[model samples]
Target: MNSDEELSPFNSFQFWRVPLPELDLSLLETEPSAGSYIAPSTKDLEAMET
Candidate 1:
């Protein structure tokens, strides 16, 4: 095997054997709370309009 292939995680069978953790995708489906939003300042809005 080439040096590149030896360095790659994909080349090892053990890499594929390890199972990934289950992710909670429900959080991604929900809308972010209004408090999380940062509204642009009036100066920034005026600059964008111009």
Candidate 2:
């Protein structure tokens, strides 16, 4: 199959990673909250979440 024929489940820059640009401190109380992360694809997230 040709490149154009291939389906893209991602953005144009598929190689670029997902960005987590925001975080709220108010969400956490006295307890220490965990870190935040972003995934390039749902497939990656599913792999980790599972």
Best by lDDT: 1
RMSD in Å for all candidates: 8.0, 18.2
Best by TM-score: 1
Candidate 1 wrong stretches, greater than 4 Å: 1-16, 38-50
Residue pairs in candidate 1 whose N, alpha carbon or C atoms collide under 3 angstroms: none
lDDT, residue 18, candidate 1: 71
Each model's TM-score?
0.33, 0.24
Clashes of each: 0, 0
lDDT of every model, 2 decimals:
0.81, 0.66
- lDDT of candidate 1 over 2-48, digit per residue (tens): 69867788768887787889998876756777778768999999999
TM-score of 2: 0.24
